[model samples]
Target: MTSPITTLTLDGLETVYDRLAQAIDRAGEDKRALFLVKLALLNAQALGDAELFQQQMEKALLNL
Candidate 1:
């Protein structure tokens, strides 16, 4: 039920995230934590719902 562009974007993001994760690992845990916070802030900004996105981000962090 997804558009081609959406699917492509998701796949591309996944690949980029994989690489980011690898680089963060090499850089150390501090960088990794910063990367996660950056992702959360980006998500909230992009979604236009800072409160809701933040709650979800907290849940994800807890689960992680």
Candidate 2:
């Protein structure tokens, strides 16, 4: 017997990523620290870089 195949949506993922990137770009430098931290966390999860994500979070917190 063959198992069912699941499909993923690239368009939706692209849309979300684009929005996040745009948000990061639009944020002011002072406000960007937090935004960057959040982006870094997401990037870490997506790219498997926990250390970098944690570093970004710490930097953001320090800036705050």
Clashes of each: 0, 0
Per-residue alpha-carbon lDDT of candidate 1 for residues 3-55, written as tens digits (9 for 90 to 100)? 22223488898998898778778868767788767766775666676566667
Give one digit per residue, the lDDT tens place, for model 2 in 1-64.
2333344499987998798778978997788999876866676666565565577568868946
After superposition, the stretches of candidate 1 with alpha carbons farther than 4 Å from their true spots are 1-27, 61-64
State, as a TM-score between 0 and 1, how close model 2 is to the true structure.
0.38
Give me the overall lDDT of model 1: 0.69
Give all TM-scores, in the order shown: 0.46, 0.38
Q: Provide the lowest-lDDT 10-residue window in model 1.
A: 1-10
lDDT of 1 at 1: 31
